[model samples]
Target: MAIVNATDQTFVTETSTGVTLVDFWAPWCGPCRMIAPVLEEVDQEMGDKVKIVKVNVDENQETASKYGVMSIPTLLVFKDGNVVDKTVGFQPKEALVQLLQQHV
Candidate 1:
């Protein structure tokens, strides 16, 4: 599935269902930019098995703060609305795939 761009208002609903990877990022963050393409590939390869959502820290501060995302590129894996796993910084495609696979 395509990566969904979520906002503070929609963050809960967007991640309320099955396995989801919530990428807390910002446009100005280099690590976030580096992970963008990797996330896209994860979406393409994982397809219906996982849902990828991105929340821009610059615009969605509430969501980021709620999750205690102290830095850019904080990736949280949620299952049925609860976080099951997490990672930070720019992760390679393989690492991301492995992270999702655990929850999938």
Candidate 2:
């Protein structure tokens, strides 16, 4: 899975252009670790159809604050640079895929 590192500078444009899923997480978060593999699986399964990006709350605080992400492992789906869907906490692969399909 290609997990692009999302930052304040790239968040708006990159996610807006096409189907993008930004996974907000921190390195020390347990749920974030649990969901990492699921995200990787999605990246491999979905291929280029959707972009999977990861934002580290510790590193990209500005981006996280902008999106009102108060929890770790927040999944935000963007379509045309606008938030279309959002999910918090660890999710199963199938559920994640379903969310991706909604925006893609």
Candidate 3:
């Protein structure tokens, strides 16, 4: 499936059961914008190997704060309802692939 969008209210349910990569970002973030296409590429290449989602920090402050997202472009990798790995800042597709490989 294509990358999904999640909110504070639906974060848990969407990320509950499988390997999910949650992008914590705001529209105004430059690096966040740069990583968008990379994430799309990963989603297309990885396919069912992973579920990708983006959470806009501006609108999902509660979830963002809950995850202690101190910066834009923070990534949280969730598996079976827990955060298994995390990375900060804009990352290349290879780095993202590495993260998924380590967890998924």
Candidate 4:
């Protein structure tokens, strides 16, 4: 499945079911840019096992703050609406796949 763009208004419902990876990032963040392609590959390869969602920190501050996302490119893995794992900064594709593998 394609990655879904989420906002503060819809973040909860978007991540309420199944395994989800929520990327909290901003356009100005270089690390966030670096991780974009990795996320895309993950979505392509493991779309059936997990759902990916992105929230722009610039436009969705409430959701970011609610999750205590202190930095850009903060990746949170949610299972059935609760956060299960989290990582910060740019992560290699291998690492990303491994991260999602745990929850799937």
Candidate 5:
């Protein structure tokens, strides 16, 4: 599936199943900007194997706070409504795929 822009209201429902990578970021964060394209490549390569979503920390603080996302470009991997793993900062596509491979 395509990358989804998840809101606080939709986060729970959207990331409730399978392997999901929720990127907690803001538009002005440099690292977040740097990681956006990498996530795109990962989304395309992984396809239905994973669900990729973006949660703008500036816009969705509740969700970000709930996840304890103190930094931008924080990536949370969720399975069945629980966070299985999390990574922070910018990472290359290969590294992201490897991260997903651990949970998927």
Candidate 6:
């Protein structure tokens, strides 16, 4: 599954109905680069069980600011449109999967 691009316009609705994992990242963020593959792996492994979305902080500053994303590679897990879990920096694929599983 391809990672969905979540912007300020789509976030509320997209995340509201399902288990959505939103990655708040910037183009220049090294940690975000490191987690890119992990997210892709999760997308494939979890398939439709979860929705993975990427938000480019550079292009979508309003959404990023709304979420109070203070650092790069911030992972926010939303269930039923409400944020339930949050992690900052790079995380291993297993750790991320576990995090997602908790909400799933």
Alpha carbon lDDT of each predicted model: 0.94, 0.89, 0.94, 0.94, 0.93, 0.92
TM per prediction: 0.98, 0.94, 0.97, 0.98, 0.98, 0.96
lDDT of 6: 0.92
TM-score of 3: 0.97
| Model 4 agreement with the true structure over 1-104: per-residue lDDT tens digits | 99999999999999999999999999999999989999999999999989999999999989999999998899999999999999999999899899989888
Q: Write the per-residue lDDT of candidate 5 for residues 1-104, one digit (tens) a residue.
A: 79999999999999998999999999999999999999999998996799999999999999999989998889999998899999999999998999999999
**lDDT computed for candidate 3:** 0.94
lDDT by residue (1-104, candidate 2, tens digit) is 47798788887766878888899999999999999999999999996889888998998899999899998889998877888999999999999999988767
Local error of candidate 3 at residue 5 (angstroms): 0.5
Tens-place lDDT per residue, model 3, 39-60, is 9999998868899989999999
Backbone clash count for every predicted candidate, in the order shown: 0, 1, 0, 0, 0, 0
Worst lDDT run of 10 residues, candidate 3, spans 44-53
In model 6, which regions exceed 4 Å deviation?
none
The pairs that clash in candidate 2 are: 16-81
On a 0 to 100 scale, what is the lDDT of residue 81 in model 3? 86
Higher TM-score: candidate 1 or 6? 1
Error of 3 at 75 (Å): 0.3
What is the overall TM-score of model 2 with all chains considered together?
0.94
Per-residue lDDT of model 6, residues 1-104, tens digit only = 68989888988977887799999998899989999999999999996899998999998999899889999899999999899999999999999999999988
In angstroms, the error of model 1 at 90 is 0.6
Please state every model's RMSD to the true fold in angstroms. 0.6, 1.2, 0.6, 0.6, 0.6, 0.8
